[model samples]
Target: MGSWERPYWESTVDSGVPRAAQRSGAYRRYLPDAIDGMALAIDGDLSRDVAVVERKLRALNGPGAEGLAGIARFLLRSEAIASSRIEGIAPSAQQVAIAELGQSESVRGVSEQAQLVANNMTIVREATTELVVADKVAVEDIVELHRSLLPNEPRHHELRTVQNWIGTSDWSPIDAAYVPPDPDRVVGLMTDLLRYLNGAAHAPLVQAAIVHAQFETIHPFTDGNGRVGRALIHTVLARRGLTEQAVLPVSLVLATLTDEYITGLDSYRHDAAPGSPPAGMAINAWLRTFVTAAEIAVEQSQQLVSAIEELRERWTERLAEYRMAAGLRAAPRADSAVARVLVHLPEAPVLTATTLARILDVSYPAASAALDELRQAGVLATKSIERGTTAFIAREVLDLVTWSERALASTRFDTRRAEPVRPVPARPQR
Candidate 1:
């Protein structure tokens, strides 16, 4: 292992029997030259391998891109759900949260975190749309994008604060690890990194890898660093217009490859030589691993999208057997309406007639009747309720929809000839 001078943050922690043993003596030197080279690799023209991947992605158009897009939406939705739940909000309440977010002309609420995520999704969509035609994007725009994602979250917004890292030392049981550079250094480091991100000397994917690693190493935020860091990947990719719709679920990939994900960051912190200079080899290894993960993520997402489309077709065929009112059919397509409602039920399984009426945009009687039909079909079950409020629960529809979407997105396809979905034939006006 390479040794280097310990950062001041590492020196300030108490070293008594209580905390001394927890400190890690392992320090890795970061070479600025390595960072520059890595930055070049990130901004450089697309490599043959990346171009091949891009062509493959483009060929995998239409259902393929749609599938990937669906997966991206779902994964992001899931992340928001998980993060909100972690912050003490119940999953079922997400509807209210989302509804409030959607209806409010202005973004303002106690659910600031959730709103930030929603905004991030919007920015990501816009950036992805623009990327399809652009060759490169400004790094300042990325910083602004990050700012937009968390403008209200104090510790996470645009500033870095003093914080302690945790690790285990040989003699110390467990203690604070290295203290990062002061705010000035952190900003300078990030500026350099962003310059690398915006430059044209490296592949976008490679840049994503190096930048992600460097951002984490910088530990720029006092909290929410991980989440924001992950968001940066989507920002860069979307800005670069790499994927169709910026549909990659990098977090999903990172979440699954938790071991390597953590190790990659650890390797950067523990393996590189101290004070010698940044080593391109160490960063490159991490980039290659990230690219591999991304490729896998894309394949998996494509498959998931294909599976979802197939399942949706099957569901449509099944639904066709019933001569339901056109108005009912007009209720937002199942995935957009019913599936969204059902996913929240793991926490609050009981949906009252009033709530159903609002959610489905039908009269209370109509909503209640629809519930009865669903219940009779064994797709929903009833639970105890008070007053005139009837509570109904969705069955396995949520799982079916979610998993099918994943399967379709993971399947690969030909991008060049693939076209966007043609407009559906219009039904006769009543």
Candidate 2:
């Protein structure tokens, strides 16, 4: 059974702190049950719900899905962005893209927040790839993920040795909304959590929900717990082969349902015995929220796939018009640099000639020519990113990316139908 313990909180800071923050008191810290060997009883209706969403997930990764290669690339960014947004790290999709470019090259006007979100993308990608391939995850793997998420913050890279709380004064755990198990219990709890992850006792979605909820409850790291917990969602799905090529972007749905998300986590933290009715109900409720988010993610992904395909078709028409106006006799060859660049636009919506060459495995001159040809066709816009480097922007693709962000923020998944529940990027200028 999981229960809370009343622990004495000793304040270590006093300068400029409020009296309440500087005072010592006893705080309730939750200690969750070890999930290893726990038998979960999911009823028939909820089982059916899980099956439906799993089917949808498999379909989204199906062979016939359009622009999946491109969708896979950008959807990773979307997932990272939404996950960060849930932590109040909001950055426009454009700013994030620029920060990504800034990672390797000089780009002016990138915000620190955007850079942090960009780092988050790397962490999310690593979670899906590295953790998925590991034969068995260790506690160190989770710590490494947190380290990657906060690369510059050396103090937070390891499991916290001191007490931490979710909401309240930062100086102490006094009157905190949620305090995790004491630091000494973190390593043991995490070991049990990984034991459950290494085994496949439940449905993929069910296991993912339990793993994520358990991780958040444990709150092992001093910082980046929410982001790491969300990333674990991907690790579970990918290791189970539910999402092979593309991310599910469930965080996009969760960001819209922030209140419900918190409530679900709270319910998962209930202090009932593991096999008791209240415990079953609490886990079931959290599973329903997760399943619904997965379903919505699949639906929104289909819409994005179709939208990207349509945009590609429009690009073809523009290229054809440009070719005719320039008196060119034949379309670009399928294996030509121009065609290859066009196909890769969604994956690399903004790229410099140097980077494009590396991405396409072509010569620098060839990549530059392909970019220039696309720019002439008005399929791409060129921006001077540095003193000598020029970047090609697939504005149409980025517009759709921005629109998808706005749509995800909206309750109806369509901005015109419902206003966004949270702030989103402004519409791209024509």
Candidate 3:
């Protein structure tokens, strides 16, 4: 079957047009068991639910009111991943450019794709935040998110004024309901899903799973359905207060199991028979997969966080031993700010001195001094000029950030590495 064909669903349309039909796929036969288990789990007492899942998350927290501390920790780390590429970082650099859209704080190199990523992140962040408060996440909200994600790209975010479909030839199945829905159908399905989502009784995980599956099946919006759909998962969980902080990095999990992730969706699209169950069973299986992934991601993230904190502490001890300058003590602080700026350097390696001043919260000269120090330290290099002004680039810092990011990416899947701990010697007091 082609990319358009749902795995288990038989194609009814000979014309190469996608159309939905009653699912007779193998997935339909087994969905009931999955759904029943999920419903039972969700309907159980809040305490039990917390015991099963929240306990794993709780271990990541230090103390009181650290609500959903797992998710919060995940969000910060994920943001690091999202913002890394703008600084000319690797791997995520491409994904970041495709996802985030905003100005960098430091003067650094950035590419067109990095700009795209910065824009995407801004849109995702705003939309997800709004979703946390709103009862129903509307198509309009999604449109707004898309607009934010691709501000300059008109075709990407614009609503479909004309009909669109996924299929190839004269045999397009108009009667089959399994194919991706048309634009009008897409809007209707999303509206219905949102209504279901806003209801009081629906379990958050179940609701999230349903919405994600339906959105994928609907394939609404010309582009970014996948990213937006994924974003919706976080929105629902956050809105329900399942995560005290943005601890769940679902994308990292999904990105890791790329093939199985797609196959799960494919199974749903094909096996969901009309007038049967709500595809809840197939969807629940997907959720189970997701839950497992989430558990693994949380564990990995906790390790990473511990590693970073430990690394920082070791560096602190080392700095004391080496008698490093106070300025060097501030270098780690620059990691976040400098990393943000460098991720944007793929498109253009220029930021106005005034902008740098605002970002670094220092005077132009101070910002310039920081740039000069970095340049002298071989961490950054000077790029081109605009109107007799200079722009700087962070080559080594970007490399370091990218190297660190690989650790995050490595944890995206099932592969686990022992957390690297730096060995620091005892410092002799003067």
lDDT for each candidate structure: 0.51, 0.81, 0.49
The candidate that wins on TM-score is 2
On lDDT, the stronger of 2 and 3 is: 2
lDDT for each residue of candidate 2 in 119-152, tens digit (9 for 90 to 100): 7786667665899999999999988887776666
Per-model TM values vs. the true structure: 0.60, 0.87, 0.58
Q: Output the TM-score of candidate 2.
A: 0.87
Worst 10 residues of 1 by lDDT: 419-428
Best model per lDDT: 2
What are the per-residue Cα lDDT tens digits for candidate 1 across 1-430?
A: 2233343324445545545444555443332222543433331332555665555555555544553453356446544443333354323223333433343323223355555445455554454355334455444554554454445555555656554343554343223344344465666677777666666466677667767887777766665566657766776665555664536766666765666777776555544445543444455556656876777766766666565556455444443433254335523455444444433333233466667667667687766775665565454667544444445754333343344334333322222233212111122121
Q: Could you tell me the C-alpha RMSD of candidate 3 in Å? A: 10.0
Ordered from best to worst TM-score, the candidate numbers read 2, 1, 3
Model 1 sits at a Cα RMSD from the real structure of 10.6
